[model samples]
Target: MISRLLLFGATGDLAGRFLLPALARLSADGRVPDGLQVVGSAHQDWDDRTFRSHVATRLQQHAGDVPIEARDALISRLRYRAVDLEAAGSVAAAVGAFDDGGDAVDRPAVAVYLALPPVLFPAVLGALGGADLPVGSRIAVEKPFGTDLTSAVALNELLTRVTGGVEEAAFRVDHFLGMPKVQALLDRHAPGRPLTPVWNSASIAQVDVLWEETLGLGGRADFYDRTGAVRDVMQNHMLQVLTLVAMEPPARQTEGELHAAKLELLRSVRVCSAAEVPFRTRRARYAAGTLAEPGATGGRAVPGYSDEDGVDPARGTETYAELLLELDTPRWTGTRFVLRTGKALGTARKGVALHFRTAAPACDPGDAERVAADRLWIELDAPLESRQPGVQVTAPGERAAYGQVLTDLLSGGSRLSVSGEEAEQAWRIVDPVLQAWARNAVPLLEYPAGGAGPPPLEQTAGSARG
Candidate 1:
């Protein structure tokens, strides 16, 4: 078991809003080791006491479900270190004290999680490479693995070198994989299952993987302005969900087998050529308008994308993105997989909707609705529902996705982490659209901040719906 967790970017928004709360949940459930130590390292000048104070406040704010005792236990295990992450010697000296002193078999496992920006991965990883961590130590990195294909491959190479050439020793996290509902969706598609019969192109018309948000860039203009819609969710989270929906069931049903299957599926996805990019993709930015609150007739005013603080109007980044992708594989040849995401939309919708071809004409004239195409909607942030008969699964109410990620990190397992090849392939799948959008091969369109996203592309019209 991993007895020590070394967290980078410990004082960042991610740590406060998600990671620390997750740790508290794990502590409450007795999922973490009793003697586990948490070492938070950042550029902040805070001492151990100050860091703990911050953690306590975060727990109070974000982890209200956790008992006070568990919150205290998690806070008790925390220690703080101020380090210059770019300096190999400084990083080594700060984290070295946590190394267990004993025979290799008796030493406790240590896991390092980089919760910082992807831009810092190279330098921080280089520092860790020089730190000479314990042989069995594991490392986990947060998402947006890279800005593009080239950088992703380079980062993968760096991670391999840092972890003694063992690929699985480094975990590339995509928290969507940790959602219990998402896992349940994958489980349903196992070979010989009920869904197996209708899972392919011949039976399914389209698969729409969507993640729309009503909220605007809430002080994330620095990051959001750079990432936009595609890189922010489409490339990582949405693609991962699509893979689980589209990949063939592996023979062994193990992590390695599943990884290979997903990689194969990703590779089979036909990348948009320069000319095809404009026809298959759409990009848009949100304009100033009113955003409706959930279930309410009223709405609040929202600023346009370019007007958001820290935004660069010259960048022409899209707040909305849509891609009409197809796989060349036999099983999914004709079926379209629509990947769409947007911010400042009228409503928040997060789920995968599979539109199956209509089965047959209705026996009763009035039963046309029931005989229409079947849409199996696997909801990620809400309850799962299916238009046809199918199992509906919900995530565990007690734990969040981050808690599952922490569990996987502590277990030293690659089952829930993205592999290097997977990361590279994901980049390959989206890079062309990015390139085309950059050179204005595809015009950047606009829509009201709280309206449905920009008008659907001609190719994607009538296929994608909330």
Candidate 2:
């Protein structure tokens, strides 16, 4: 029922670039309601008119060489307010104009978006708790839901306590849930489909959720140093992706329906055995080096993660991490989950590779090279696949079986995708991982920049070749 979108951190990195323009494009397409109100908030002291200019700059940055029209029209929808997020009345200040009880058809409720840091969540919620808002007032929380399991649980409890309820009134999001390809993954694995029961079955040799980033910590070095790639990418992002790839088929297909399916997968996931987990997880810290430009220049010298603006000097934090996982359920007794992520990779892309058992035994001494493992790319994020026809058999990695599932989810909603509850469950699965890391969970596994993960991972990855 929320009609107005009050975007927190509206002037910051995300809003200044993607979110705002997405909303603008939606408006231009006439998809948004006529009275759809877009509000922006920040700690900087600025009037609405002044804030409008700040947002425009971000859009231009994302626009790149693409042409944009009627910039003012999109700008007209933006409203900004200066707020001290930590102060007592910050929530009320950010919740700019309000609409009294109005007809449902004429006006809708408020949608407050929390785009700032997790620490500020409590303050903002406290402010809203004291404010006089209606029952249907919905609020959104961003990623890195909590630093660790304890923090995540506390944050969830805090939001529920502050809001007095955590039902439809609160919404948690992962942009991947909005992708097209993700929806297809759901569609691919339905009740009677080959993908569902086979999702976790040994039928699949293994599943790899790969998240790669070309840019290292750079400006976020300090933040990246502490969180590392595990917390940054694998924990939240890939966890959700894995949930979809391995979960059971739900009775229904709505977000709520999908949530139930995902929860079962989380509950079934076998905790990585101490030995399997310890060495299975890999971390690499990118050192200063020059990277090849491919077609442009010979190469560019990029500072290692430690050189990032805000990163700690002696940080052993990894910009890249990989983990091997499995589920205890009957479906996937021995199937493994390989999670790999890095900031200083050669490219930027996010997707899952499902290496399936095309043959019964999975081994052929006669023609191991000729035999192929059907690997499908459930592209929830990037690095799409293309298989132009009339071509002969291609290698397992080179085949066009690459799919664009995530792309399908975006530009709209995807059924088998994660909802607030699913996202929370995914968080719960990582609770132990987070606690382990917070308490120096495992000895740090460090690797050089522009390379693969830690040296120990080479041994850990012995069984993950699938």
Candidate 3:
């Protein structure tokens, strides 16, 4: 059981939209342990009652479906303190409250969660290093670990130094990995299966990993403008999903074994050279257009990417990105993996699809010579949904992605956490594309707000799979 949870950005969008709702669900399901105290710290000036009122309001807005008893119980454990996280003395004071009677042995295991922006990670960690933390304390950090490879390395080094070089004590969260559908895919693809034998270039023609959202930037223009689609989605979430789909089966399902397998797969990923990037990747920004809904009288008009509030027209931010990558490993030499994501799309298509090679032509005179390749699609429309082998499976006790992440954090599991090495390798794989785009080596195309992405690539026997 996690004795205490110190939330650094308790008043941020992430906290209100995701973290608090997840904690409420855990409470409703009896997953959170009894007597778990939660402390909220932020730069905002608010007392306990004000903070509780804020939590109550946000809880109703985001998690209205949760039971009143669960919400009330969660609120009862919450307390607030406003602190400048950069100030060592302020952080120390907030952390010192964990001590009930100044008895070191009696203190509970504390988990510090940093929900702030990535730029402030180092300052927060530095302050925590000076604070008198309890034994068995863990630190959980949200995604976009760093902007690039160099910063990611520096952040990892700082985390290790502060946490006494105990890698397991640092949790790098990626909620996509915690989705039950992802776990279900891992469970279905265990050893000794018909598909397992054909999970290679010899039998598979191509793979597509896509995440398209119909909604545009809600109110995050400042963040989204700086970090475009590639860094925002491809580097962390999409790469992690690709690793899962392409990784070799783990020796066992333990966290260590699974992470090792994923790390190895990432290490084998090949980035396009500067000269090859133009042909292998595509970037586009959405223009103003109408988004048609089924049975609606009229379509809803949406603004262009450049027209979004707080967005600079000169930045050339992309709303849609697609990259064609190849794995250098012998097992996947000839196969291609397409990674794509976009906002303000016509439809929300999110999942991984594996297209296998077609069978040889039939011998019968009347039979068709060629047929569509067989596909094994794993749908990840939402947290609890799962579809495998064309059949939907609803497993009991399925939890939301954020809830699973919390369960792992409180229970000392790192399966959903990305390691330092994995973070660096992911950046390495995309750094070239980033550089190319900055130099304007590749053209930035424009597409309507609601439309299928750039016309599908000419369908070769190989490209027909996606």
Q: Identify the leading candidate in terms of TM-score.
A: 1
Give one digit per residue, the lDDT tens place, for model 3 in 275-394: 777777788888987665544446567799899889997988888888888898888988889888988778776788777786422222321122344665667654232222212222
Which residues of candidate 1, in runs, are more than 4 Å off? 100-107, 294-297, 359-373, 383-399, 458-466
TM-score of each: 0.91, 0.82, 0.90
Best-to-worst TM-score order: 1, 3, 2
Rank the models by lDDT, top first: 1, 3, 2
How well does candidate 1 score on lDDT at residue 17?
76
Candidate-wise lDDT, in order: 0.82, 0.61, 0.80
lDDT of candidate 2 at residue 36, scale 0 to 100: 62
Model 2, position 157, has a per-residue lDDT of: 78
Q: After superposition, how far is residue 214 of candidate 2 from its true place, in Å?
A: 2.0
> What is the alpha-carbon lDDT for the whole of candidate 1?
0.82
For model 3, what is the alpha-carbon lDDT of residue 364?
Answer: 25
Instruction: Give the clashing residue pairs of candidate 1, or none.
Output: none
Q: Candidate 3 deviates by what RMSD?
A: 6.0
